[model samples]
Target: MEQFTEVFLEFINSWGYFAVSFLMALENACIPIPSELILGFGGYLIFIGKMSFSGALFWGMVGGLVGSLFAYYVGKYGGRPFVDQYGKYFLMKKSHVDSAQHWFDTYGISAVFFSRMLPVIRTFISLPAGFAGVNLYKFVFYTILGSLPWTALILYIGMALGENWQVLRTIGHEVSIVFIILMVIVVGILYFRRKQKR
Candidate 1:
């Protein structure tokens, strides 16, 4: 992990803002690249005068939007079968798709907006949204809206922490784990309840 972090940091350092867009794009594409690390490091750069807050925020959001659209299309065209059959190669799971689908089913279009603020759900919700055939413009609009605060908050933490920005990455990672565990338990309960109803 340390070595990976070094490589990731070096990549961003070498490429400047483009790295922010590329890395964040990969993250939102459900590639698990860790936005916290990207944005946090971006913040640290801002502190050192290597980046501007607005530039980081703009590029980060752009990357997120692009990546999400990519995932959305994958879900729209590929649908569930593609994910079920080939998702494992990308570290995706049927359960993840199901959970995202359930959230969309339960919450409708608003789920797209709100889920973007969450951890695991934020990353996976685009897939189900695409699969559900949600309006493209609306998805893009809400995606940008939902991502703004999260991107800003992480970047702010990174900036405030400066050289210690990696701390946010560590904390964000732990928080994501907790959310994943909680999601699993909720999925398990819901599964059992449905079984009981059947």
Candidate 2:
């Protein structure tokens, strides 16, 4: 993993902003490039004046949209049987894709909006969205909308920690833990509110 991380960092170092787009695109396309590292590293560079935050963020989103389109096409054309046959190459299984599909089905469009803020679900939601054949424009709209804040937050985390982006990892994990707790509390409140109204 360290060797791979070094190679990835080196690639980004050589190419500048385009490297962030490429890696982020690959990540959204099911290649697992770790956006945290990419954005965080970009953030560090911004601190050093090597890259602009907006430029990094813009290309990151563009690359993500492009990669998502690729995956969407794949899932739309390939379907479950194709995934069942070839998913292993992407380090995936039918079950993983199925779980993503189930989430998409259960939650409808909001799933697309929120999934971009989550981890595993963010990666695979495009598959089921494609398979289900949701409106293309709406998918693009919601995807970009959902992705913007996440991209900004990740980049900010990266920038804040500068060269010590690993520290951002700990920060991200803690944030996720807190987010989950907050979601639980919010849901409980809503549930009780509904009961009282009834």
On TM-score, the candidate that comes out on top is: 2
Q: Considering only N, C-alpha and C atoms within 3 Å, which residue pairs clash in candidate 2?
A: 40-158
On residues 29-128, what C-alpha lDDT tens digit does candidate 2 reach at each position? 8776667777878888888888899999999999989888888888889986787788788877566677788889999877887777776677788888
- List model 1 lDDT by residue over 1-198, tens digit each: 345888889989888799999998988888767788899999999999999999999999999999999999999999988988988898776777788899999998888877876777788889999888899999999899878878888889899998898888669856555644665698799999999999
Q: TM-scores of all models?
A: 0.84, 0.86
| Candidate 1 error regions (>4 Å) | 1-3, 173-198
Error of 2 at 110 (Å): 1.7
Off by over 4 Å in 2: 1-3, 177-198
